[model samples]
Target: MSQTLISPGISVANDDKQRLGPRTRFGLLASITVTFLAGSSVPTPLYPIYQDQWHFTAMGISFIFSIYAISVLAGLLVFGRLSDYVGRRSVLLWTTVLQLVAMYMLGVADGFTDLVLGRLIQGVSTGAAVPAVGAALIDLNHKRGAVVNALTPAIGSAVGALMGSVFAQALPYPTHTVFAALAFILVIQGVGLLLMRDIRAKIPGAARSLIPQFSIPVDVRGPMIIASSLFVAGWAVAGFFASMGPRLIEQLFALPASWAGGLVLAAFAGSGVAAIGAFVTRSMHTLAWIGALGLLIGMAMVLVSLITGSLTPFVFGVVISGAGFGAGFQGGIRLVLSKSRAEEVAGVLSVAFLCCYLGMGVPAMIAGYAVASGHGIFDTAIVFAILVMSLSFIAVYRMISGGSRV
Candidate 1:
């Protein structure tokens, strides 16, 4: 809270201390973050069903989806840097509570307004949770590793989307049932938070100041800017998968609404696996290029699927794209972490995540608005595919030029 910034790097006397055993406690923390983060996207595959039940248009669906991004952006701006001052546990506990509120709202949604409001709350919860959860993973590490930390959120997103979509589509009373499952998981996470021992390196005089400040050294700013761009591109890919894929599947492939979630899950699962592998491979440079290449190939695949009108190709394209997204995200986190210190972690990472949520939320909303007025879903989907693919190719090209390695 004080005006005096703690010198960067780990904020404690022993930044390298292993407070909890690496295996059990770390896994527990990762699991907790994954469960709730995944829940945030649990509703992705079911938006069509909601539309059918509520008589909302595609534009309305986009608006509802946009709330999550807007909420996440708001959370990052307001509370993104707060965890730097407060302990991670405190922030995470509160985030869990927010998720509960969101699920409750969604479980009983009656109209378009309810859907938008509920998604907004879920967005805020996830936005707050991501930085805290991500920072906590890095903080808990005795040995340096990016894959494990990155995979926590990456894999969780995939698995959660899969579970939520499959169960919601297959089960009776999806609206209530899916959220019921999420609410139960939130309760379980709350208990886990209570049981886990608090482990954080404290900074003297850091907590007293309440104002959120974002600071990075002059030299690091260039890399940070480029990292943010990469985040934007990757997140746009993710947003499309969540918002548009289900609708596309329903309209084009004639797939049952229930199986749409599987498409989202496949992409996340591909990305999660790639992220974990990237973490352990010890050649981050290789992984970075892998991400770039994946993005190019995956985006191309998506364009092809659009042209061919094949469901199998479309789903496959999504998974390939997701693999690229995860790989790129993992690489970016590694670059940021290597360049950052503990005091600066939340502030620096917040900027990158801000770009991500912006990418995820903004365009999707615009596309949604387009869909709402009796315009064709395919027209909007085409625009989305083009925009995301363009951004991704540009980022990859810049990185290939050695402008942004991550």
Candidate 2:
């Protein structure tokens, strides 16, 4: 049971005979990361279907969506650092099992209550698994790990939204089919985990780690704040698209197809993935500025589309803002992790993602209430775009004034 210390609080169990190779482990971990996120977003396209079937209001949909975020926050607070003491593989494996249960619940869901409960379970599983898998990736390769962490959400969301849409449109049982597929994938991922190595050593304080806390190092605090702001701005837009984009598209643009919502979400997420490659060589500060400007310009276009009642501009605006979302999020993550010690990886990521989920959940929930309370989608979206634009302006100013020090 010999172990090698990789950092202050992290260690590798040297059991080459029993564990998979590092490269193999990295690939598996990355796949698992993508799978978990994909599972979370798979429900986006199905929201419209659920609404149609159950006759729920916009506020009901928002509750279902936001409840997932709330549960994720609970999971992150309680279990974010558990892997830092127990082991990454164990945490991931158990969470995968929980996700499978969630998929089952969602797959067989008959109404709103079932959907809400399923999402809550799914969110908790995703929340607990995120920090574990994120830390594991970093444990393997710091630079690549950060890139994967930054890029995977977009990639997984894009894939999930598209898949769910296609399946919902073409398949017999819309909800059942997608969740079954996700559950199958999770089963494979769990098996893969059993074959892989646990890179981190089990440490003491496993019980104390259950208490909710953030462990950000002093050096990482400044970048974390900047990153948290970017996360809040970017994910709020994503949340809106996920929860309300389909309805907005149907109402304003006259596109009633099931795939339209998924396409809009996919475009936003896909553009983000593309932004990472286009701006990979840029400095962190420059990337942040570019992202902010992109958000501002893109949101302005969205406002125009709303006013003019044109779909073309809306599509174009989504692409641009989505690019900004991707680039800005990457810059924020790179800045935060660039200064973080290895020991701070899990805690830093936990706080970062907590903010990310908060941003994603809160604004969308508010918009749902507004829409349900008499504000039209167009009006609510206009206000939402304005708020995002304001945030983007602040982000740009922060980067310019702070310079490389940020």
Candidate 3:
């Protein structure tokens, strides 16, 4: 306990105002990234459960998932760089509180409206927290920052999908329990943030505009579009995994057990996480070709699985597809960051995320409608795969044609 002077003569123990060491601070920020992103997918495993109890159609499930994407896009469009204006710590703290509220809503949700509202709130919470957390992580450790940012969300979503499935299989009230558990973890983090020192200085004109801002800096536009297109293509598959992979597996393969669907998604994401590193070290053009090739082989394998009524080919397809996902997404983000002006970093990154999530959300919804309207699942997968391959090859050709260089 230490004493501090007050009014010249009075002194009291100031033990409550404790300061954390650097390692602890870094750990806290990293943990926040993991937990926030994990929360984003915790519902993936539970979607089936919701479908069963609520008696909703496939389109309903897709809409439920899509709404979260919309909420995130809206949040990023408005507040993506708010931390650059406001203090990062302050923005994180408030969003964390809202996140807690969202979790509580999920726990008690008995209706579709409640569920959608919770997801939207979650979108806002994660949306607001991600940029600040990313910015703060870089602030604390620039050397490892880029790698961490690239891998953390994929890994976190994988963990969430796996654990949510596990919890659903092992515990009661799968949806309520999973969200409640996440809420508890968030509470501890929120309280910790309240005590930790703020790191980012508040910039001027933080309150000057609430209008949505968007653009690609002119110099980086061509390369950014190519990279972002790859991200979009990869994320399209990623979104399918998160929203409909489980249901599709059940429908097509007659997979048993409620948790099996989530496991597939976890595998897909985990494989991508594993592949991100080897791909990131390559030149952007090389990454484009490799990613395109991986995606093609992966989708073809998935087609083989669908044709043969075999789970093995599908699982293998997931792995190869995941590698392409990692390669395309990470390579794009890395290239953009390498070339972005310091001031353009946050805004440009927002554009990248907007594209990535748009890919994740929009296509999944369309596929959902098609499936719901009696379109054959295998036929839809074939069409989607073809579209993704076309985008990937276009990226490769763009790279080859010198729109973007090595």
Candidate 4:
């Protein structure tokens, strides 16, 4: 089954035209994956600067952030399966172009409207590209691809947040420099993608594929349900940090350094990357259990830090929670995809990511509104931590009680 998926419908003549070896193709695709996600997070550390310059309300900031998630969801629904129908390379190329355009818009953004529009475009590009590239990775090497898919989000996000912070603090134009740099990288990646091959054959029903759909194969549904909590718990924590971490840093720790929020986010995401690498060899169930426990303990420490207004413990909590986030998310991906077929890759991955973005976008939006509605950042953080901790507890119970058994 895996062999067929990797070499579907390629004749001798087509193979002769292939420009890069499988290893090279995989490397390019992996880099593209990392870059796409990095672009999405590049703006996270810049949000505080935007607020300071434009004086946008917390609700307004939330709207800006949530708009990206909403657009990504729309893109996912509309284009998720298009790659399976048309081809992975085609979808990826077009989306990379869209991402380039988004970076330009964001670089020049002078106001809230511009920021919102740029984020919308960025979101759509991500939506369309995620499943295509994801499917392509699996096609190239299922085992490595799955691991790369699991690791890229954390790695990309960590790099983006940290880079943005560093550039913002050190460069002349904080906002413009990062976007421009990212745009340049995208340009290079787009050219590289042209040299790559689309291993998946173009199936019939291309037009119908444009219609929005979400599905998990019958065999995958049970694992999907079991992994859903892990998705929510992990990403909800991420969403909180991305959208509100900077503000939390300012309000709670009385630190006004631009790099502080980005540092915290980098630590959180970087730790997750480390955790995924550390536990990549573990069984899916074991990874899930570890992730759940990490989330529970980490969130508890975070809550304590918030209550005591201790920055050190808060940082420690962030790192621990980040590890859980990575491990749990990776475990969830492995669990759901464990039973999926090659043809089902795009749809399954799309649904899986849909759950992820929902977890990432919704709670942050709610927190934004809550803060705007007179709940202080600390108060909101406490409430958010408690909620995530509760979810983590549920995930732990589910994993331990054999509820996730397929």
How accurate locally, in lDDT, is each candidate?
Answer: 0.70, 0.87, 0.77, 0.87
**What lDDT is reached at residue 38 by model 3?**
84
TM-scores for all candidates: the values are: 0.88, 0.97, 0.90, 0.96
- Number of the top-ranking candidate, with TM-score as the measure: 2
lDDT of 1 at 309: 84
Ranking by TM-score: 2, 4, 3, 1
Query: What is the TM-score (0 to 1) of candidate 4?
Result: 0.96
Give one clash count per candidate, in the order shown: 5, 0, 0, 0
Which model, 2 or 3, shows the larger TM-score? 2
Query: What tens digits encode model 2's per-residue C-alpha lDDT throughout 317-406?
Result: 999999999999889888888887887788788898998899899999999999999999889999999998988877776766664575
Candidate 4 residue-wise lDDT, 1-406, digit = tens: 1223234432112444569887888888888888988887778778889999999998988899899988988989999999888889999999999999999999999999999999999999899999899888887778888888899989888999888898878889989999999988988988888887667667689899898987779999878876888998898898888888888898888886368888888899999999999999998888888888888889999999999999778988999999999999899999888888878888898998898889889999999999999999899999999999999888777766765466
Worst window of 10 by summed lDDT in candidate 3: 6-15
Residue lDDT tens for model 3, 261-301? 78887887788788777665676566666776777788778
Q: Name the lDDT of candidate 2.
A: 0.87
Q: lDDT score of model 3?
A: 0.77
Residue pairs with clashing backbones, model 1? 1-206, 1-208, 1-209, 9-342, 59-368
lDDT of 1: 0.70
